[model samples]
Target chain A: MPTKTVAGTTVEVNDEGFFTDPSQWTEEMAPELAEAEGIDTLTDPHWTVIRFMRQEFEEKGTGPTVRALGKTSGVTVKELYQLFPKGPAKIAARVAGIPKPRGCI
Target chain B: MTHRIVILGAGTGGTLAANRLRREYSTDEATITVVDQDDVHVYQPGLLFVPFALARPDDIVRPRQDQLHDHIEYIQSPIEAVEPDADRVHLTDGTVLDFDVLVVATGAALLPEETEGLTGPGWGEKVHTFYTLEGATALRDSLAAFDGGRLVINVVDMPIKCPVAPLEFAFLADWFFTDRKMRDSVDITYVTPLDAAFTKPVAAKRLGGMLAERGIDLVTEFNTGEVDGEGGRLVSYDEREVPFDVAVVIPLHGGQPYVGRSPGLGDALDFVPTDPHTLQSQSRPNVFALGDATNVPASKAGSVTHFEGDVLVENVSRFIAGEELDASYDGHANCFIETGFGKAMLIDFNYDTEPLPGHFPSKVGMPLLKESRANHLGKLMFQWFYWHALLPGRDIPGIGPDMPTTGKRSPESESP
Candidate 1:
């Protein structure tokens, strides 16, 4: 039950720093989380995917698959990789304030 | 003087290399000796199916002496040290064998202690791995008790033997649960340190899609710093955690301990630094390494060992004859990926080409880069081929060390 101070707000995190609970997520908290994943700033494209993923999770109880996101979010698999290098779905779901998505690898 | 070619380890690489070398030289011309810690020779790939009950533990392992040629002398003793400079290997029982040529095929070993808390409390209970005969056998018992909940398979690091085995385990787990009618209650997740589902992009995309279709979860780029087995959590350095009810892990792999005992003979990880193409040890002309024992960028698979053994045997012959060594190994390797439900996919490639779609080995042979029951049968048939054809060092017609491009489609030619 470790806590990390993200964007001047302390949040419960595991040993690695991912938020323990997504319900406690706030819009202002993304900048801190994104920075830790090695992104300098969240741009329009990043927000487009992030917001789209969050909305999809809220409505469907699950986030979009990478293939689904690429087709619907106007981002190609290559472009999504550029936006989120290591793993887009997992990182975007985290930045968008959702629990880790299934099949994100 | 009878030339001595001492080979360390009597597993896939060592066993086959010993047999192949025996074929090249007569008993009067050269003497061969194979040394191992024990008589056990486990078909490592078969361990992948043991937990799923697809394979019996007793069926996978055979005596090392049974697989080797009678002409080859076998030594059962622990390796204390290897003196590369003096051209001798020290055994724990105080026997030192000198060699004119040496093949260091003692392959990579699992290092569970490298990751924090992996071997601690609940290690044999909740946390299990199918990488060894004992682990796979133990997992079979542990899995029977698992009614449901999160079953996580984590690859602690890369460069493991039969790299696709973990994914196959996940795919087979999906099949196992569905067959048991508990598929709904069970949640299977694959956590890897890599970004993609696999190493190569083309294959990763295909495998990733299969994972999505099967409802198996994938957690990527998770550099696990610790395994909280008691708490049932895999905590990564990035602070991301994947909770688990039953855990199957692929621990970090490293070369055998004797590699560390010999200076300038191996890399920091104890993997011998070889001319990747030649399979010759970078340190000395008389010394050579192949299979998982070498830092060869090639897949640390038995198929790679099979193909490498083709070139390695020839190189050993040339070395003994005082001729310029040939760099014949192309890093050529092929594998059948079990995707479950009586279906599998095959991939064939070398250092240059990624896995391409079409027929393999021949124009009308099994399909590549796609799943079919034929590949599954081919995967099953490989066990027979391994013991009978591969380990006996008999070269199959139309197959060699270098990769063939006749039957595969070039990536650019496809419609995107």
Candidate 2:
């Protein structure tokens, strides 16, 4: 596992830079992770999605998919793309310190 | 009192479980009943080949009850709802069947209506799907009439049954057009909501490379918001557009509507909240689920259902006998991926392991993660096996529920 410094804190991450140990993630790490993924700032809407993702991951053992994030994360699917840009489910999970939402291959 | 087992769906999981359970218990000791909405049990795997005209639609379907053991009771009635608390099932025909154990195997249903304009102007004309018998047949006609232009294969969302089927359809389409001597006039593009061609990393990389090599364009992370079939464009949630001359779209899938009707039965998607390892429903002690009906994070493929049958049958029996349930199911799943022409690739994996490059069953058995004519032959031969060995619950020689690792090579081993 590779370790990276985000927000002055060293955290373990996978090959794709998603947190290997989600417990190492702090609320302060969200802004830096967001910036790493090309987002300029951590706005209130971004935090709402990030917090929802974290809570969902804690409860379900996995982050919600883009559809689930849009439906239940209090963010519209259009707004999700506006907030996260390219991949909402993936980028939001990264900032929230959760594993990538997987589909069976 | 005789132990009553009511297995719903009568599809792959339900039929196999019924047959296996029947063999375990005599009719005097237990009564096995299987229910489904209809008698036609279409060989779902064959649906993948239907659009390509490789398999006839009529040849792939059979009477559902014919597959079950004679001792097992078969009911043809649409399920109304499952009263889990009362251990009763209400059918649309007004029959309420009581059971000591209930197995929910009612598989996923395709919902094209969920997306705006998907079922609009050119639904059966320009935009088509191969996920259903009707869709596959309609797509066959559409593809036959299609001579040229941009042909896009779009997957609407994830967790769809046979996740690799859409990819198979694309590969076969390349072969189909080439066979017709019209390969040049056609441009093939594969669109998906995922970040890659597939979910697993190794398989994705391998499959993605194959797509590029075949000159099939891959558009990833595209969350389709609407299908403008009349205008011939797919509008994403982000407003990115992928224009198509004809679109083969795999629509969003959810569990049967009856699952949602039953309170405390299913998740947001209507897939039963199941214990992934145990194959038991989280809602009630006597309730269990398998196959596409459960939100178990496994591929919704027939092989997964076949592999799961062994564990699910055992656990169902255990629950009835007042014994400990077996939690041995390790999310084992395998699929034969058709890669056009006369070759196909095989992949075998389980929970905690991604599809790797190696042989399956044993080191010398068959090539894994690489296209081979032998795997293609295996794919062709599986239809016969599906009817004879698989649905009857007979044990396949040398293959068990657990994923075999003997022939597999790990990434770490290769790196060192």
Best by lDDT: 2
- Model 1 accuracy (lDDT, Cα): 0.86
Instruction: Give the Å shift of residue B70 in candidate 2.
Output: 1.4
Candidate 2: where are CA atoms >4 Å away?
A: A1-17, A21-47, A102-105, B413-416
Residue A30, model 2, lDDT: 92
Write one digit per residue (lDDT tens) for candidate 1, span A1-105: 887777787777665455567667788888878987888899999989988987887875577655457657887655787788766777787687676664311
lDDT of 1 by residue, B1-416 (tens): 67999999999999999999998889999999999999999988899888888899999888999999879999999888888889988999899999999999999989898778999998988998898888998999988878999999999767688888999999999999999999999999999877889988788988999999999999997867789999999987656899999999999887888888887787556778788788999878889998899978789999899999977988899988999888868888898999999999999989878888888887988899999999999899888888988898987666677898989987788648
Full-model lDDT for every candidate = 0.86, 0.91
DockQ of predictions, in order shown: 0.02, 0.48
User: What ranges in model 1 sit over 4 Å off?
Assistant: A1-105
Clashing pairs in 2: none
Worst 10 residues of 1 chain B by lDDT: B262-271
Candidate 1 backbone collisions, by pair: A16-B238, A16-B239, A17-B239
Error of 2 at B285 (Å): 1.7
Interface RMSD of 2: 2.1
**Candidate 2 lDDT for residue A27:** 97
